[model samples]
Target: MTPLHQQICQACMPDSSPVMDDQRASLMSQLPGWQCLLQDNIWQLKKSYRFSNYSQAMAFANQVAELAEQMRHHPALLIEWGRVDVYWWTHCIANLHYNDFIMAAKTDQLNVNSG
Candidate 1:
């Protein structure tokens, strides 16, 4: 199977079902440091990355934005002085999907390559 980071996100429909239970667990294993959480009654994949300073954090956020545009799957990003918090979910589905996992893995890849 292809690594999650290497997989491209497919277009999701509003009626699509969120990845659940065993599938969610399996995918989550491929991404370390990411937490599965319920926010606003919806499941999301979240992680926080630390940087040396605000500039570094903003750079990382920009990288993430580029990745999101390429994959056509965006995340919620909270950029601060030295950290960035990312939350990935399919808003159309109003929950977590495989695309979220893919984006999370790609986000990790960006951090690895940048550091």
Candidate 2:
């Protein structure tokens, strides 16, 4: 990431409690792979990829887990067959946060690169 963009991201905070409608829209656009759930203000993503059968899916899940751990953030993970769903929100912020969306996008990038 560029230094300027990194600076901006570092300065960001989670969306304020009771997420505003417009902010939600803006954040959703910032996230390409994730879909914004209006009512909950959470980002949700589901993707299916070829994974050398079930073992590959498991490996990918582990990778995601490691990423989340290192980020000190977590996303709800649902693994089924060859699909994975990631749901991200900030509990402390009580809504979706900038970091959450950023990390979600990073996750997508990781998946694409791995593929």
Candidate 3:
């Protein structure tokens, strides 16, 4: 099977079901440093990356934005002076989907490629 980072996100609709427990567990295992959290009754894949300065953090955020655009999926990005927090979830379903994991993995790759 292709790695999550190499997979492309599919168009998710409102009716789409969220990732099941077994699948979530399997996918979660593939991503390190990511947390699965529930907020507002929705599951989100989140991670924080540290940088040396604001410029580095902002640059990473921009790279994530470009990735989101390319994938047609966006994440909530919180950029601090030396850190960036990324939250990935499917807005239409208000839950975590396969795309979320894919984005999360790809996001990790962005950090690796950048730093």
Number of the top TM-score candidate: 3
Q: What TM-score against the true fold does each predicted structure earn?
A: 0.98, 0.70, 0.99
- What ranges in model 3 sit over 4 Å off? none
Residue-level lDDT tens digits of model 1 in 1-114: 999899999889998888988999999889999999989999999999999999999999999999999989999999999999999999998999889998999999999999
| Candidate 2 TM-score, C-alpha based | 0.70
TM-score of 3: 0.99
Which 10 consecutive residues of model 1 have the lowest summed lDDT? Answer: 14-23
Model 3: lDDT equals 0.97
Candidate 3 on 3-114: residue-level lDDT in tens?
9999999999999999999999999999999999998899999999999999999999999999999999999999999999999999999999999999999999999999
Task: For residues 1-115, write the lDDT of model 2, one tens digit per residue.
Answer: 4321132223334445544668767756655656666345544433344466677777777777887777777777778777667776766666666666666766776687678
Model 2 lDDT on a 0 to 1 scale: 0.62
After superposition, candidate 2 runs with Cα above 4 Å error: 1-19, 38-52
In model 3, which range of ten residues has the least summed lDDT? 37-46
